[model samples]
Target: METITFHSYRGGVGKTVLSVNTAVQLALLGKKVCLVDFDLRAPSHQSLFISSTFSMSPTAKSFTGFLVGDHEPQSVINSTDKENFYCVFSDIEIFQQKESKVRTKLTQHGEGRILAKLFEFVRYCNTQKFDFLIFDCMPGVTYRSLDALIVSDKIMVVTRPVKSEISGLRLVISECYSKLEGAEIFSIMNQVENIKDLVHPPNPLDVNFAKVNVLGITKCLEESSVPIPLLHSFPRVPFVTERIYVLDEKNHPFTVEIETFCNKLLQK
Candidate 1:
């Protein structure tokens, strides 16, 4: 299993959206993929498949349960409608309450008690024969998110074109990748208006500091009311009323870009 962690300096950069879509596309391409919602604090990967009326199994019975030994890690792995694709969601209820303790246990002793258990989880994932394992790590520099980054084979930093985001992005690159000897950082710029803009190196001054090869840049497909990426957005169709259906609009601009990005990711 090859692990990839999607991280951002802050939220609202379409990190989860891109992770969800890329995982699905990877599955569609015949890779046995697992998308993990490791964003423990405000876990919302379920929102991708959720709608006004539909709900998934509660988080207490999810991955967060595995975090605290409430359930076996294998039990928390849930299947999606897409074949060969699965997801593991963070437990908002338990995770928020236990985060500090979890963080301490993970980081205090350098591969300490908590991480030892989590490594068991990773070993279990390795046995599952998955081709691609992806994590939607929580935004910012939390200990838990950093732990995930440490375990991943590749770190994809998702950022936006805004000034504030760029500043933070530089910090993330300098602190996390510049001096780090082992990990390779992949840069993905989101919410750009035009593909032409990507040709100019984003945050040119930090190119040396980041040490990341640009993977791809995607356009923002957001609407006013939703205030989130439109890649997961679904409207009421003829038969489906309340459920968010799988996106099959191959010709939609957003879908086109997502597929293109997925292709680029595989090429790299």
Candidate 2:
């Protein structure tokens, strides 16, 4: 099975939204896809899945449980109503509790063990004949994020067109992504200014501002230490909150973009 990780230098770049939609879109295409929420610090997948129309079976264990040797890989995997779609949610409470042993297992001097557990989960997915295993990883360069990067076959670095993000992306590339080996790296320029599709006040000044920002982000990616090809660009859909758009509104602009991205990703 091919393992893909969706990561970002910072939060609020729509990484989780893209990863969840991509996993479901692949499942809709009859591919067995398993998504794991590896964002332990601020887990969001559990709430997204619970609120969505998607159907998920009761999970006996979370990803944190598996990492801490409290559960087996299969037990942590929760099947969804959509055939070929499965998920492993992260427990946020474990990360929030200061004295939580699960948090200690992930944060302390157990990175090697954590990585081994991640690989063990991957082996289980392979044995299950899954077509793809997707990881919605934590943002930035943490030990846990490194584990996700090392175990991935392809890394999707999600970034946005903002000054802060540009500088942070450069730091992540120089310090983390450039050091990684044996994985195909790609960038997803998300929330890009879609001037052609702008449907708001239609201010010329706003348009010009957006153009400059997009160029800045593009240039930052182009000048990275390691060569990371541009995989896809997702336009900013106004007023569309993060949801399972692909399943909720297949014809929506955001859904269309996601479908297009997934189709392109399958080719790689």
Candidate 3:
């Protein structure tokens, strides 16, 4: 199984939105894909799918339970309403509580236990025969976040056009390179208005510092590039607020392009 993790140095950079959409698109193409909500502190992937009607289930159990020895990792694998996509929801509240308790325990014991639990979870996912395992990681460099990076085969750093976002991307890339030797790292620019319009076009400056593999650009369908590119871009679309019937893949621009991207990835 190939594990792809989406991460960012800071929040409010549309990591969850991109990760969920990417997973949905891949699933629509009939690939067995699992979207793991590893963002324990601020869990929102489940919210994106069910919105206000979020409920805990056998598959949607909290990661905290696994971390604290309350439950096995398999207990947290919850199937989403979507056909081919499943989610492992994070229990943000429980994570925060346990994080506070960490101080009481020996530092290495607390940290090591969490790392071991996460690796065990990854080994379980490998056994499940998933074609693609997408991890929506938490923002910033936390022990939990680093654990995700260590386990992943490929790391895709998502960022916006803002200067602060770029700076954060640099830090994230640097940290990932330092720990994950010889891991494939790619950069994707999300929510891009116009590639040419930006005052300073993003070049390969500090990218080499982290030894990043540059993926092609993704723009809106109207503004999309000719011959397409490796990176899949989408126009700013209306948020799917409430539960609605899934649209046909051909009809939805975002879904169609994303599905195409997944096919291309498989070919590679």
Candidate 4:
């Protein structure tokens, strides 16, 4: 199975929205896809899929349970009503406990069983004929996030047009390159207000991210210079707030963009 992980150096950079939209776009293309929520500390994908219909239950069968060996990984697969998009929700409380334990062990052995469990989960998905496995990684370069990066085939770093965020992206790149060695890495610029006028914006913070390959709502997807050019940019639409929670593909601007992006992925 091909694994694509969406990561960011900091939180609230629209990583989850991008990840979920990308997965939905891929699914609409008739490819079998699984969107796994590896952001154990703050799980939100489940709500996006179910429209807040279901809360992440902190039970033995949840992702936290699976990670802590309290339950089988297979038991954590929760199928959303969305076609070709199954989800694995995380339990924040359990994740904290397990992550702490895993981190301590990694310091001594340079390894841990969590990675093995993640691999096993991937293998299980492969057996089920999943064409793509999209991981929505948590922000930051914690041990949990690193595990996701290690297993990912391609890493997409999401960022905003801000100085601090861009600095964080550089650090994220450094960490990923250090651990992933030669894995494919790409960047997606989020919440871009204007691409043309960015040559000299009022906010100096925006200038820092100017060096990286960027995608904006104003640019045509086919004309993008970035490797694995952005699939689509949402364009600060008010409807995105309402559409993000709903599964209906027609009303959502992000969903439409995702569909277009998915077509591009298939072309690859």
Q: What is each predicted model's overall lDDT from 0 to 1?
A: 0.64, 0.89, 0.63, 0.65
Rank candidates, lDDT, best first.
Answer: 2, 4, 1, 3
Q: Pick the candidate with the highest TM-score.
A: 2
The candidate that achieves the highest lDDT relative to the unseen native structure: 2
Off by over 4 Å in 2: 196-203
Better of 2 and 4 by TM-score: 2
- How far is 22's C-alpha from truth in model 3 (Å)? 1.6
Q: How many angstroms is residue 15 displaced in model 3 relative to the true structure, after the best TM-score fit? A: 1.3
The lowest-lDDT stretch of 10 consecutive residues in candidate 1 is: 221-230
RMSD of 4: 5.8
Instruction: Give the C-alpha miss distance for residue 228 in model 4, angstroms.
Output: 8.5
Q: Per-residue CA lDDT of candidate 3, range 1-268, in tens? A: 8888888788876677667767767776787788888787778766655553323344456766676667887787887655777777766665456556632331234647777877788788889877788989888887778877878887776666555554565566456545675456665565544334345755656444322322222222113222212254443444533232123335664555456656656665
lDDT of 1: 0.64
- lDDT per residue for candidate 4 within 1-268, as digits (tens), equals 7888888888888888888767766766677888887887788865665564433342225665676567776688876555676677776554456557643543232466777777888888889899998889888878778888888887787767555664565566556544575456666667665545344545655543443334222232233333334444444444455234324556565666566656665665
Clashes of 2: 0
lDDT string for model 2 (1-268, tens) is 9999999999889889999999999999999999999999998888888888887756558889889998999898888889889998988878888986767888875749999999999999999999999999999989999899999999999988876787898888988899999999999999887777665667888778777777877898889888898999998888668689989997899999999999899888
Worst 10 residues of 2 by lDDT: 193-202
The collision pairs in model 2 are: none
| Residue 98 in model 4: lDDT | 56
Candidate 1 vs. true structure, TM-score: 0.73
